[model samples]
Target: MSKQPQPAARAHNGETRPSYSERLWVPVWWWPIAVAVTMLLAAEIHMGAPGIRAWLPYLVLLPLPIWVLLWLSRLRVEVTTDADDGRELRIGRAHLPVEVISRAAVVPATAKSAALGRQLDPAAYVQHRPWVKPMIVVVLDDADDPTPYWLISTRHPDRVLAALGLGTASEPEHDKT
Candidate 1:
């Protein structure tokens, strides 16, 4: 699947635009499969049916799968500057202030299973997608907050780290030892 174009930041009247933005779209191959399945189901409903019954199923069922896929693809990840909080990482509906981020690292595809499995923290905030192999782990230092860290799936882990200003600055704890 071809990567979708990253959204370009535009400056308007000194407003701070998002430094990084990505929509976690489903794989391109999934679209055809979804359409085919919906069509097959519609065909089954249309079998020997006359007039509106045949057309109605197609009208109703056809858009249903497409709508579902589109809705699922709407999940977004963004890094933007906030007047009150400096920089903030936005994932879906949740936002994390950069100031609270104590450390960050890119979790390679090989370590992903372990990261999400045994090493996973129950108090962590995780936004995972199987289609996305790599992820960013951002450890939070806010003593008041119960969440330990954030495990977020991303196609471009390096870019996410850079956008968060953790690239080359924060290193994985395992590497120090």
Candidate 2:
């Protein structure tokens, strides 16, 4: 079969950047809710405060929520090629070489619970996000590596599979024997 061209993004310099990157950001709706909740908490702390204590709480506590939300949304998933042209999948701080990826399957939203609960192996590497439903399960072939596979949470599973060159292996885990 002929090899298909990989999806790429244009770099800032207008160069063709070959990589797939996705950030697991918190939903936009959560921002206002977070700010509202933080304000309520700060208001409660401000009650009956003497002088600067009232306004001090607002100044200090307000940024706390924003900082926390930004921090929580920092998880990123990236697939990039190395100097040898081998692909690597980086999920958050963890990195997995595509060469060792024996099999990969997209776990649908319906089976996410079971995959994370019952079917999950204790030795497996899992990057889960409650905001994201669908996931990609990558089975490893490295004997030296004790980890069996990686359960990664991604909003675009199809694109992730395509980036990893596992587009044809997008079958669900339960479908296989």
Candidate 3:
């Protein structure tokens, strides 16, 4: 694939330039589950059936394990600086514009703090992997979009935050009740 030149983004009225593009894929830890499932399937076929023909099917279905891996790995996320002077987050087949983003924060990798995947905001547009470490939580402007926010996993969350120009100011303001 051809690499696009990094572009300067107007983030919260300030210019934030992205230095490089990165694609985040499925974490390495999930592959073992796929292998286990495939092995279980093979075992079921081998022990349950009483004929020699039953084992023959396992050979034909040898690619099933790889297929499972490929399916899980299909969600590719590309973060880059576009020529339109906007930071882009290309997750799966969707492209999210980071220009109108209002807030961004880094989520910790601990069990209680790793609020990713199904544990995140239901109204949010999320693309998360359980095996990935820290995640980036981005809140978009509610006026222009249907998705309330986004929860994405990234290996280099600091760079992703930099690309979005989300510093300490990205934190939400709490009411003094």
Write one digit per residue (lDDT tens) for candidate 3, span 1-177.
112443434354455433445555555666777677776777777886788867765775667767766787666556555455666765666666666678887776773253653466777777776667777777888575677778877777777777666763344789999
For each of the candidates, the C-alpha root-mean-square deviation to the true structure, in angstroms, is: 6.5, 6.6, 7.9
Give candidate 3 regions above 4 Å deviation: 1-33, 36-40, 47-55, 111-120, 167-177
Better of 2 and 3 by TM-score: 2
Residue lDDT tens for model 2, 1-177: 111333443454543344799999999999999999999999999999989887998999899889998999988888876545677787776777788989898888999999999999999989898999989999999988889989999999889989898884533468555
How many clashes show up in model 2?
A: 0
- Give every collision pair in model 2: none
Q: Looking at model 2, report the run of 10 residues with the lowest lDDT sum.
A: 1-10
Q: What is the lDDT of residue 151 in candidate 3?
A: 83
| lDDT of each candidate versus the true structure | 0.83, 0.83, 0.65
Give the worst 10-residue stretch by lDDT in candidate 3: 1-10
Q: What residue runs in model 1 are displaced by over 4 Å at the alpha carbon?
A: 1-11, 82-85, 168-177
Pairing residues by index, what is the TM-score of model 1?
0.84
